[model samples]
Target: MTDWTPDIVAARFAEAAETARRLPPAKVQGYFNVWPTLLRMAPEQKPNDDERHFPPTPAAVERMLEAMRWMQMLDVDSRHIVWMRADHFEWSQIAKRAGSTVRTVQRRRNMALSQLTENLNEMRVVAASCK
Candidate 1:
C-alpha cells in the first residue's frame, strides 16, 4: 500500500485551500441587472500590479472535493484548526480564535494531520485489496 504521511496530508490541505481560492465567486440566484446596457457605467479596470487569478482545473477541483470529504473524519475543533493552518493563518491567530496558546494550537494541528494520514493510508490499503 502507498504510505500516506502527515506531511503529504498537510500538503493536500494546502492545495485544497489554493483550489478553493481559485474558484469563482458565488452569486445569489435570480439576481438580474435591471439597468439598461446603454446607460451602464464602464467596468473599473484593476491595477496592473494585481496578479491575475485563473480557475482551478477539473483535476484540482476533484482533489479539493476529496480533501473536503476527508475533513469529515475530524472533530469540529480539529477541522477548524487544520483548515486555519491550511489557509495559512499564523499559530498566534489560530490560538487567539481558539482561546488557547500557540503551542496548543500547533499540537492540535499536528494531531489532526496525523489522524488524516493514518485514515488515508488505511483507505489506500483497503482499495488495493478490493482490486
Candidate 2:
C-alpha cells in the first residue's frame, strides 16, 4: 500500500535486478518456480573465490524479496524486459537476448511498467479505503 511513486518503482526495480543477479543461477532460470512466490529465490550459495568480495546485507535481502513479489505478479515478457533494463542492458541487447525486436522489447517494458503502476494504484486505493 505504499505510494507507488516513480522513486519507489525505480528503487524496487534496482533491487529486483540485483536480486535476479544473485539468484544462484538456478532460480533465475525457469527450471524451478520456487513456490508461494519467488521471494525465497535469494542466493543461498556463497560467491566463488574468484567472484566479488562484498558481503550481503539483511536489508538488501529483504528488499530483493519484496521486489520479487511484485515481479512475480507481472507477465513473463514484461518482467524479463524490465529486469534486463534495470540491470543496465541496452534495448538492442535486451532485444537480442530475448529473441525479440528492439521495438517489441521496448513495448513490453512500457506495458510492464504501466501494469505495475495500475496494480500498485489499485492496492493503494484499497489500502486507503480500509484505513
Candidate 3:
C-alpha cells in the first residue's frame, strides 16, 4: 500500500468540504449527523445484513456518496483529513478551545495546507510531463 501523506489527507478533506458546502442546508446537516451512525455501525456485519442498518438520513447518504466519489478523484485519504479540513473545525477557535495560542493553530493550519497544495501541484506537473 502507498503511504498517505498530509497533502493527500488535506486534499481529500478540502474536496469533501467543498462538496458539502455546495449541497443544501438540510443535506449538510444530514451529512454531519450521519457521521455518528457511520462511526458506530458497520454495513456488512448484521444478522439480517439489512441496508437499513445505515442510519444516516437520505441527504446524509447522498452527501457521503458524493464525497466518496470526490475523494477518489483527488487521490486523497478521506479518513485522515477530516480534522484538518475546515468543516470539522474553526481554525482560529481551535487554539482557544485547546487553551493554546492562535499562532500555533495558524502554523499547523498553514503547514497542512501547504503540504496538500505542494503534493497536488507536484502530481499535476508529473502528469503534464508524462503527457
Estimate every model's Cα lDDT from 0 to 1. 0.87, 0.73, 0.53
lDDT of 2 by residue, 2-74 (tens): 5686456856888767755665443455577545422222365445543433334668778877777888879
* Per-residue error (Å), model 2, residue 37: 31
Looking at candidate 3, what is the lDDT of residue 38?
A: 40
Q: lDDT order of candidates, best first?
A: 1, 2, 3
Tell me each candidate's TM-score. Answer: 0.82, 0.66, 0.38
Candidate 3 on 1-131: residue-level lDDT in tens?
Answer: 24445566555556556555555445544346433544325655566444333333666557556545434434233223334444666655566554567676666555655655566567767877999
Please provide the root mean square deviation of candidate 3 (C-alpha atoms, Å).
Answer: 13.7
Q: Rank the candidates by TM-score, best first.
A: 1, 2, 3
Show model 3 residue runs off by greater than 4 Å.
1-15, 21-85, 88-92, 96-99
Error of 1 at 23 (Å): 0.4
**Which candidate wins on TM-score?**
1
lDDT string for model 1 (15-105, tens) is 9999998896788998866654232223654464234466699999999999999999999999999998999998899999888999999
Candidate 3, position 98, lDDT = 45
Model 3 residue pairs with clashes:
none
